[model samples]
Target: TQGKEKVDDAEEVKFEIWKKNSDKNSSMLEAKHDQHGIYTAKTVIKEPGTYTVQVHVTARKMHVMPKTDLSVN
Candidate 1:
């Protein structure tokens, strides 16, 4: 994920994924709907560390952002 603003379209699900490791930085990403109720995206994480992942979802004038942590081995 990187610092890129996603222009949200109407009536569509907009996903902006933000990732930052132990090092303070900026990034973001998105994925398509492959299965029912499931969204998938690919990201290249080479460094092994703790990453703060903030998920931003916007759809039909509804916006929700949740933050979590990811540890890579």
Candidate 2:
């Protein structure tokens, strides 16, 4: 939410990830809650480079997408 509160009862959570500027390596996966106020999704990328990860959160009729960049090294 706009208040930055915790969403413990989300209807769905997903992660859209890809290597920057490359759609061939892109993937979208449903995230699983670890029951620790955190969600996780895993994928194997053999190549090492920079990538973008976008988190999609849906709950209580609201949806938020937050993205960030990371390096695999």
Candidate 3:
């Protein structure tokens, strides 16, 4: 979802969520691939704060990391 291109069949995707101030407060979830190369991950945020969501993609012997900020009310 972070990249413009579609994911390849051999690629592996992971979704990571973490608190902005703490590396220990992090969660990693494996993404499920759907039709049309869409990858999805669901997580429940119990705390209301600023967090970072990163997409870790591995494909073609390379790794790509894309991250975004998320604020949960």
Q: What's each prediction's TM-score? A: 0.63, 0.83, 0.81
Candidate 1: regions farther than 4 A off: 1-23
lDDT for each residue of candidate 1 in 14-58, tens digit (9 for 90 to 100): 344334533446466665655544555677787776777666666
Q: Candidate 3, clashing residue pairs?
A: none
Pairs clashing within candidate 1: 1-27, 1-28, 2-27, 2-28
Q: What local lDDT does model 1 show for residue 23?
A: 41
Off by over 4 Å in 2: 1-4, 23-25
Q: Which candidate is the best by lDDT?
A: 2
Writing each residue's lDDT as its tens digit, candidate 3 over 16-69 gives 899888865779999988777778899899989999999888876778888999
- Sorted on TM-score, best first, the list reads 2, 3, 1
Look at candidate 1 and tell me the lDDT of residue 11: 32
Q: Is candidate 1 or candidate 3 better by lDDT?
A: 3
Instruction: Report each candidate's C-alpha RMSD, comma-separated, in the order given.
Output: 8.3, 1.9, 2.5
